[model samples]
Structures are given as C-alpha cells and as structure tokens.
Target: MKRSTLYKDELIVQIMGMTDKLQRRFQSEGVDEERSWMLQQTDNPAVISFLKRATMMMLHVIDAIVALEPVNGIRIASHLGIPRGSVSKITRKLVQEHVIQMEYLPDNKKKIMFRTTSLGKEVSKVHLALHRHVNMNVHALLNRYTPEQLAFLAQVQSDILNTSLVKEDLASIKDDPPPAAENPPEAMDMRQAAQEDPIRDLLDMLHQLDSANLSKAKDLLQVVFFAGHNG
Candidate 1:
C-alpha cells in the first residue's frame, strides 16, 4: 500500500478512537458528575432537590425562562430549537417543581407565559455559574490554538457533519416522522443537530471575544503552536 494511503487510514483510526472516547466521556456518568458538581455549589435544599430531579432539558427550559421571562411556550420552543410539545411538557414540570411559574397577560388572558420564580432564579444563577466555569476551562484550552488552527478545526467538524451518512440520516428522518410527536421530522433533526454540535457554540464565543482577550488568545496561541513549530 502507498505511504499516503497508510497514513490516511491511521489518521481515520485515530479520529474514530477520539470520537468514541468523547462519546463515552459525555455519557450518563459524565452528566451525573457535572450535576453533582453544580449541586455542591449551592446550599438551598429546594435547589438541590430540583437539580437532582431536573434533566438537562428541564434545566435549559428554566434557563430560558430566566433569560426571557414573560416568554410563551412557542417562543421558548423556537428559541431552543425544540418541539412545542416538548417545551410544554418541560414547562409543566418546571412549574410543578416551583422553579417556574405560569402567568397570563391582562391584555391576552388566553396566552400563557412563563417566568422563573425565586427558586428558579437561584437555579439559573447556579447553572450559569456552572457553564461559566466550563467555558473558562474550554477557553483556556482553545487559546492554545491559533485562529488558523481553530478555523481548521471548525472546518473539520463541518465536514464531519456534511458526510454522506449524516445527510442520509437527515433525509430519512424527514420522510419518516417519529410516532410519539406531532412535530415535523425536519425540526427534530435540526434540534438533534444543534445539541450535537459544540463547534457552533465555540465559534460564537470566539466571535464574541473582546479585542483585549482576542489579542491575548492570539499571543497564547503563538507561544503554544508557532513557538513549538519553529523549535
């Protein structure tokens, strides 16, 4: 076999191994560990119990309500790229947990809206802090790569998503809607894609970095990548 073909096969094996490791690392055990870490950050029993009971989807719903109070279910569904029915179910649980409360506008009594209660605000605060902690670590790691390297990584991720297998899966989903929900299969595919893609989130954060931070990041990357290469 050609050396180039051998190298390509090895690279594919390495990539697949890394993907499998990442998948395992973020499975249920990883989630429970993160949830435990978040739980330790607060003393309130209600918040503790709520955190214990809440799924990631439930936490996201509360976070959305905290960020966009007086927002209705449909808007939350759209904002989160989830089904309205799923949002409805999550909000009902949130209300039951007393993390969020239902409200009706005086002008439109028929349209129900959601707002976080004091408990919910506390929960949101903790969740935000947890994310900030995670982001800080991720940012520190990513700062080790130059902007060019980051862009290359993004392109690789995009390529993976655009592969024929993923495209076929998406196409099939559009034709065969799930039996449990009335939502269009296309919307479901989009939601699943959004959940699976951290590259998009990373790109957004990179774009949002202030000039001072961006310069600092570039300097760090130069030291980490360029300095090593030149040596």
Candidate 2:
C-alpha cells in the first residue's frame, strides 16, 4: 500500500481505539452522574430544548458582539443566517426563560440588546466542561501513539470534518424524500414496520442517511479518472 494510505488506516484505528477507551473510562469513573445527566436530558424535553436554545443564544451573542458591535434580535438572526421571526421566537423564549437579559437602547424604544445572565453563564460552563472533558479523555488515550501518528490522526480527522460539512451542504439542496417503489414487498414490509415502530424507523433512516453521507464523502475525496483523458 502507499505510505499515505497506510498512515490513514493507522490513524483510523487509533481514533477507534481512543473512542473505545473513553467510553470505558466514562462507564468506570462517572457512570452514575453520566447516567443521571443523560436521563435528565432524555426525560425532559424542556431541559433538552433549553440546552439547544442556550447554545444558539451563546453563539448569537458572541457573533453579534464581535461583528455588529451591539446586537439585537434582528442582527443576531442576520449573523446566524436564520429568519428574524425565528430569532424573535428564540430570544423571546430565552428572555422569558431567564437565560438572557434584554436591554433597550436609550435613543430608540424599539431597538434592543442582549446579554447573558448568570444562569446562562453557568450553563455555558457546563457546555464547555463537557467539550473539554470529552476531548481530554480522548486525547489522553491517543497519547500512546507517537507524535507522527498523532499528527497523521489529526490530519485525517480534519479531512473527515471537512468532508462531513460538504455532505451536509450538498444534502441541503433536497426538497423532498425520495419516492419508494410502489407495490414492492420490501417496501410494504418496511412501511408496516415503520408504522408499528416509528422511533426505530426514524433511527434506521438516520443510520442510512449517515452511511450515504459517508459514502458520498469517500467518493468525493478519492481521485480517479481516465489517465489520458483527464491528465
């Protein structure tokens, strides 16, 4: 095999191993707390949605402050490439939820600005902690590899992340689901099964989409053409 091809395979193995080790360590060290947190999010739709809203709010706040100087809902939505109505919905909900505080500009009654609350900051800390802990755990496991191996793994991960974005960007062009084959037995069975167990069907659809995305990504990254024609 080519040197680069071999190196990529080694990196994939290291990443898989690192992931396995982190999962095991989590189970061993903080299983109870982890389980509790997972259950809390899983059981409470409000809490889960709050986390999602909090993250969007934090990013909007950061981006608005950086780009627009002083940001209101309109500016936040513009920066995020979302609709103003949606931004208003999220901001109003966040304000009512007390995760953010709004301030009106003195010159204009209609103009408003936002700042994170203490509660919001606390949630941000938890979000950051989760990111750091997971990354550190994975990196610690990866440290067994040599510096060269680590560099190769990092490059491979970077490529994968980029390809994932490409896949998502391409997927966004779709307006509707693909049509199923009519009167097919496999389709009938799948339809019946999906009707019986919607959640499982949804999961299987996601898995299939994920596989397609990765397959498309692999095809995108591979270099192949008729030798004389392209060259």
Candidate 3:
C-alpha cells in the first residue's frame, strides 16, 4: 500500500476505535449509576419516576417542549429534525408520565399543543444541570487547544460528516433488490448488512444536529479523544 493509503487506514481505525469507545461509555452501567445519583437528589416521586423511565430521546422532547411551549407535534418534529410519528409517540408517553400535557386552542379545538407540567419542568431542570456539568468539563478541556487546532478539528469533523461511505452505503441499500423467498436470512449481502451498522446511524444523527449542537458535539468528541490518549 502507498504510504498515504496506510496513513488513511490508520486514521480510519482510530476513528472507529473512538466511536466504539463512546458507544460503550454511553451504554455502560456507570452512566446509569450517575443517572441514579441525579435522581436521588430529587424527592418528588413523579419527577423521580419520570426521570427513571425517560430515554435520552424523551428528555430531548421535554427540552423542546420547555423551549417551545404551546408547540404542536409537527413543530417539534421540524425543530428537532425527527419524524412526526416519533414526536407523537414520545409526546403520548410524556403525557402519560404527567411530565407534559396537551392543550387545544380555544379558537381551534382540534389543534393540539404541548407544554411541560410542573413535574416536567423539574425533570428538565435536572437534565439541564446535567448537561451544563458535562458541557463545562468539555469546554474547559477544549480551551486548552489553540484556535488553529480547534479550527483544524472542526475541519476534520466536517470531513468525517461528509464522508462517502455513508452515502454509498445508503445508496447501495436503496438500490438493492428485494430478497427472494428462497434466500435465507444469512444470504443477505454485505451492502444490506451495512444498513444495520451503528456507525451509519451515528452519522445520520450527526447530520441532523444544528450548528450549535454540532459544535458542542465536536467539543465532547475532543474531550473523549484526549482522555482516551492519556489513559
């Protein structure tokens, strides 16, 4: 292999390693323990119960409602770049948990709007503090890098986001023929299997992030990479 190709391969391996590490860290029991600690700080049974059951996506929906009270499901979906169906499902659960409630305009009784309840606000407050703590640490670590280094890192992130693998994988999946009845599940092609890759899902999620959130994500990645190197 050419020296450049070798270096590119090494970079790919490093990136994959970093992504795997992040996935493991997020899914680890330690994170759950930390969440449990956060929950213990609050005494409200409703808040505690809701927090315990809330997924990250659910919390994100609550945050959206907090920011955009009296918002409809369509508006929330547009704001978050998620599907309306997903927003509807999450909002339904949020209403059941009493963290969020639905409202209808007096002028249009059929129009549904959402807003956080008192318990929802409390949960939002706790989640906001959690985010603040994480962001503070990430920002402090990121501050150590010079502006040029940060700029280069940002460029790297952009390049990764614009990689062709994601496009090719998606395109190939879309162009594939439907499986024949005689084909066993194990007969699935490599391109079809690529659809199940978590990295592709991660890339899709990154693409959905707005500029501010993307910057925060880059900072968090830098922190994770720096910590990995030191450890």
lDDT of 2 by residue, 72-135 (tens): 8777887888888877777677678776778888989888888766655555545545557668
Highest lDDT against the true fold, candidate: 1
- TM-score (C-alpha) between model 1 and the true structure: 0.68
Q: How would you encode candidate 1's per-residue C-alpha lDDT over 8-37 as one tens digit per residue?
A: 779979998998988998887778988999
Rank the models by TM-score, top first.
1, 3, 2
* Error of model 1, residue 134, in angstroms: 0.8
Candidate 2 — which residues are off by over 4 angstroms?
1-70, 74-86, 161-231
lDDT of each: 0.83, 0.61, 0.81
Clash pairs for candidate 1: none
Model 3 pairs in collision: none
Q: What does candidate 2 score in Cα RMSD to the true structure?
A: 22.0
The lDDT of model 3 is: 0.81
Which ten residues in a row are the worst by lDDT in model 2?
A: 174-183
> TM per model?
0.68, 0.39, 0.64
Candidate 1 residue spans exceeding 4 A from truth? 168-231
**Candidate 3 RMSD to the real structure:** 21.2
